[model samples]
Target: MAQKERVGVVVSNKMDKTAVVAVENRSPHPKYGKIVVKTKKYKAHDPENQCQEGDRVRIRETRPLSKTKRWELAEIISTKAI
Candidate 1:
């Protein structure tokens, strides 16, 4: 099976070797037929600890590295501008 991937913005990188990413999912409401945005936070493994808050990154599904870390950072798409 192909591993799942997600593109999201890094929300926090306070933990060592870990980063919290917020991915947004947009879908039409079942009853109202209006677009709704849902955000989910995922803990991704960042071996290099390169991610910082507000950075855009790509994460891929991987074997659990820790209790809540099932995703690994693939690449830094864009960094937060200073």
Candidate 2:
């Protein structure tokens, strides 16, 4: 199996018992080394997942939870925003 990893910000925790995370990715241009931004959203499980907006978090790919949820909360790795 392939291991999955992602770093993101907790955009919302307003669901009944879940959190909506927005993972923004930054990469450098291939030739010029200029930064570029990309983003993706993941709906992860939050069992006692007391996270708030603007909080940095880590998530991992997992089996489907609902119709569109295929990720799970892995860990909260930081106490400050990057």
Candidate 3:
């Protein structure tokens, strides 16, 4: 039983207590070492409605609260800082 963590971009924070985040991962090719980009979208529980779209955030696996929610916002790693 290990916890999973990820860094992603906030896609939407319009929900009352939730936010849609998109995680992007870049991997190097095994042969040519070319970087490949991929993105994944996840629904995370915000509980505070403080996240905003385009903001980078870290999330962790958590107890499911609904059919589509199994992640929670852990922290804001980097932001525009305004």
Candidate 4:
């Protein structure tokens, strides 16, 4: 089976080598049929601590590196503009 991958923006990188990423999911409500945007936060392992807030990054599912970090940073899609 293919591993899960997600692209989202880094919301926080306060931890030593962990980053909080916010991924948005858009889907229509089952009954109302109205589109809804739901945001979820995932803790991804950033071994290099290269991610900064607002940076666009790709994360891949992996073995748990920590209690909350089950995803690892794949690559930085785009860096936050200074």
Candidate 4, 1-82: lDDT as tens digits: 8999999999999999999999999999999999999999999999899999999999999998878889999999999999
lDDT of 1 by residue, 1-82 (tens): 9999999999999999999999999999999999999999999999999999999999999998888899999999999999
Error of 4 at 56 (Å): 0.6
**Candidates, ranked, TM-score:** 1, 4, 3, 2
TM-score on alpha carbons, each prediction: 0.97, 0.81, 0.86, 0.95
Better by lDDT, candidate 3 or 1:
1
The clash count for each model shown is 0, 0, 0, 0
Q: Where is model 1 poorest over a 10-residue stretch in terms of lDDT? A: 63-72
Best by TM-score: 1
Model with the higher TM-score, candidate 1 or 2: 1
What TM-score would you give candidate 2 relative to the actual structure?
A: 0.81
Candidate 3 ranges with C-alpha deviation above 4 Å = 30-32
Model 4 TM-score is: 0.95
Task: Give per-residue CA lDDT, model 3, range 1-82, as digits (tens).
Answer: 9999999999888888999999988999899999999899999999988898888999999998789999999998887567
Best by lDDT: 1
RMSD (Cα, Å) for all candidates, in order, is 0.6, 2.6, 1.6, 0.7
The segments of candidate 1 whose C-alpha lies over 4 angstroms from its true place after superposition are none
